[model samples]
Target: MPAAMTIDLSAIPADQRDAVAAVLRERDALKEINRRLEHLVAELNHAVHGKRSEKLSEDERQLSFEDLETAIAEVEESQDTQLSSKGKTRRPVRRNRGNLPKDLPRIEHVIEPASLECPHCQKMGGCGVMHKIGEDRTERLDIVPAQLRVIVTVRPKYACRACTDGVTQMPAPAHLIEGGLPTEGAIAHVLVSKYADHLPLHRQSQILARSGIDIHRGTLADWVGTAAFHLGPVVDRLAEHLKVSTKLFMDETTAPVLDPGRGKTKTGYLWALARDDRAWGGDDPPGVVFFYAPDRRGENAEKFLRGFDGVLQLDGYQGYNCLTRPSRKGGDPIRVAHCWAHARRKLKEVFDRDGSEIAAEGLRRIAEFYRVEANIRGTAPGQRLSARQARTVPLVAAFGEWLQEQRLRVSAKSRLGEKLAYIHRHWDGLQTFLHDGRVEIDSNSVENLIRPIALNRKNALFAGHDEGGRTWGRIASLIETAKTNVVEPFAYLKATLEAIAAGHPKSRIDELLPWNFTPSS
Candidate 1:
């Protein structure tokens, strides 16, 4: 056993020094150990299982235009009967049915000045000839031609042929593609189709070629990559601005990456973070960000949160525990609050597997706390705190007591025991928010932020590689963050691209951040 180093209090002033400095150093060490234990318990209960199988990525069997048309036909057949019934029930009586015109007639009326008289009629008032005005009725399907129109720049020029005369010249107008094959609309269409609409480049090329555009898949790929490159710095600037926010939520989901070496794809995680008020307040919109990494390693989180500060609310991923620790270099450690929903979710999962009476009661009590939260969700922060204290603090206290009592009844090895342990382990951090008003009860804010990416993932399948995944992270960060702040994403993207093209300095690009961006009216 290692002996403890003692302090001599007799040499030091009684008010300035402790009599036993190293007496409980082991106790201090146990504090961190306990924190780790708590983190582990929470993580074990909330662990997600299984990735979507790669065999499920068949493009041919998935819903296509014909399948969609068939479905639409079925829906229309069902709706046609309802439509007939609706018309019979609500249609007004047609009073002029018999008098209605078969064809709108040419009722030509003639008039003349009072001074003029028709020679044939010999009238002093007016002279005119009645004639039928032709009319036609028809209907055609409205369709715009999908043809490319070339811009012609015919620069007509002349030069003087006299001695010591200067020559005149005309320059050609600039085109998006003087030598290339894509137009601005084509670029926007491809980007929106791929990233926003989730149609793959190969699929888009096939669709375009079918419509008479001789575009290749490789050309579309170049356009996408070039766009991402041009847009990269704008994303970085947006990310820098995202760091300055006070509250944050974080989560991750699987993103498949193609591996030609393995003759298949590999599973990767798309890690996302956000700051928003949706779960807590409907009035306050959210700013979101996403980052993709190959693994769920803690260093990835560290990299993601490098410049970020303030409260970071996350699920029960032990990787985030590293942020709570003191930095060896300097400054305050990033404060972390574990999500209550995450803690509750674990217990719910176990409850689903094996019905436990104790877990049931605990959940019922926790649900009451959420009920109180929901009631005051839209109120001001001070009022929310007051209501929480008045109504919710008692529930939390009673729930804590119930948890302590129930912890004894469950078996240590049983699933119920694991769930109880999870709730007990993070009890302090879980309740920490009751004291501070800024911390949220759950990571749902970030979860909501990442949902669009999840939807896109379902449709597009996965990123091609790690670099492609990073691009996903960068683009999602800007677009989603812009969404929270109510800034038009394309407008932001266009302006950002223009700035980058104009050689705007990177350090000063923070002014273009979504929250700070002032949009044109």
Candidate 2:
């Protein structure tokens, strides 16, 4: 049996007490290093073997566009229920069909045997069955595009012959453009082209030319630019409505802009703000609004979020602190939340770099927290909070203690040290979700929302200017928020644009907003 290594502190002489403390500190540091190595190995093994880890291991992640009905149906099927009143059983689509006997009877003979006669001997010979080989077949699930029809309105005016007053009976109802070449449908097409399709004006002109439309890209661009200008009031109203929500998720990404004067491009930031609560049913399901700035200073976020109050959940961006900071006018601070995914990501990166055993263990413990939340996804916010509180709070505390101990053992310049620093720095915000039932464990839902923009940015590169980027933000906010709320973006945009053109009251624009509105069946 090993003797208990205990020193009687009371009996230690005054001169040697400091020496004893130093020895104890060194012993503890060595123990921490050994523990970290063990944790790193365990994390590597878990990463190799776990399904959840496989999800995070992708290099170039693809954003999947899931059909809303299909997703709702999936939710229904898993619970052995139906989403629709028809009560049909919902089943998941099979990825691969199981093997069937090759000799199974066919509905029709795939090959009819052809009698062969020998050319040299004139004797009937049995024909050999041959199947032609071709290239390996690749398959994709087929989808049918929705049938679209444009309604053209023609109003004929007649003079009043009986009154002899030679007055046009009635002027035709006004259109978005009176003498302009583009019809309402044409304008809708152009808007959809520029915004939803991400096709630049020049590219669209060439495409129109291929279709014999003979419209210049400048004309399309002018029309769009004019439309966006005229719709400023509507956009402003939408932004105001979105900001009124009690919670907002925000993120930013780089957007490149063309500069004709400098003969070089410049980078800008696309700042987004939204209420991203898809799991919770509310007036604010999702309300994304975007802002564009030449620089990504904290002030840019401050400008967009002015007069907005309530929780702002975000990754650990210092810029967001500007939003949550107390106003000079003596108002409440913007409530802030830090994402757990960001913390986990930092640790994951460190573990990848240093292969630290402690980092791996920390990740495993953190992953267990996410696993509990995953099981309760889409449940009531209260239920999610309760589950997390029960399962996550303890793990987080232990992880924090572990981190503090490991921080002292690792080199301050090492990757492990950086991970510890990041976690420690954001510890308060990371754990704040535990106290609020409405808060989520991570900003993943908003991250999922931002991913599409990231993909689009990769393809289109950037917006034309700050105004162009703001337009992108405005449109993306409405569209992405509409998507999150299960409202078709194009349909919503088309209807909202029409309403705005018809002089719909700016104050009542909330009727056209994404989260507050639903599609007409």
Candidate 1 collision pairs: none
lDDT tens digits by residue: candidate 1, 36-134? 545544443333221222223234224333454455444444444444544534234224344544454444444534543345555555566544455
| Cα deviation of 145, candidate 2, in Å | 9.7
What is the Å distance of residue 298 in model 2 from its true position?
0.6
Tens-place lDDT per residue, model 2, 135-182, is: 454344445433344456677667776787665645555566666776
Number of clashes in model 1? Answer: 0
The reply for model 1, stretches above 4 Å from the true place, is 1-179, 277-285, 327-331, 502-508, 515-521
The regions of model 2 sitting more than 4 angstroms off are: 1-59, 63-154, 160-163, 281-283, 327-331, 516-521
Cα lDDT of candidate 2 equals 0.69
Q: TM-score of the candidate numbered 1? A: 0.68
RMSD of 2: 20.5
